[model samples]
Target: MKQATRLMALAALMIGASTAAGCGTSAPVDATGLRRVVGTDLIGARGATAADQRKIDRTAVGLCAGGVWSKDECERHGEGAR
Candidate 1:
């Protein structure tokens, strides 16, 4: 009975560790998705010239891909971009 309890505890510990590790990893960024977001934002704004739009796109990409924003924020914007 003691050995069975020990085995169960060990299994539980392994499962917990794996779950924690998975939570720490994030999904890869979708570049096209992010670009679409920047495009949408630029379109929604009034009086943004082509030059201004280009600049905004560059800045958005930098922010999302340069590790300035969290993965969740990037993903949120990516979804919006689409």
Candidate 2:
């Protein structure tokens, strides 16, 4: 009975931690999904080259145009080169 109670407590703690992790300000774009869409490893980070940045911007604008993402979200995700 004691072991069962401990297991239950551990399960509850794990659930709470996972829930909390999803509650914060998360990235607008899923990196893996974006990579798939862009077909490149370049993430348009602060250090990205101009060409890479342009590619990222084009993808973001396409996402926005297609209603896959909002303008604000695109901007927040650092893909808004406009």
Task: Write the residue-wise lDDT of candidate 2 on 20-76 in tens digits.
Answer: 545767734434543344343233333235564555455555555655556786666
Q: Which residue window of length 10 is worst by lDDT in model 2?
A: 38-47
Report RMSD (Å) for each prediction in the order shown. Answer: 20.8, 17.1
TM-score of 2: 0.36
Instruction: After superposing candidate 1 on the true structure, give the runs of residues whose Cα lies further than 4 Å from its correct spot.
Output: 1-47
Candidate 2 Cα outliers beyond 4 Å, as residue runs: 1-47, 77-82
TM-score of each: 0.31, 0.36
- The TM-score between candidate 1 and the true structure equals 0.31
Summarize candidate 1's per-residue lDDT along 1-82 as a digit string, tens digits.
4323323433454356345545646854444643443333433322235554454445446556656556885575446335
The per-model lDDT (C-alpha) reads 0.46, 0.47
Would you give me the overall lDDT of model 2? Answer: 0.47
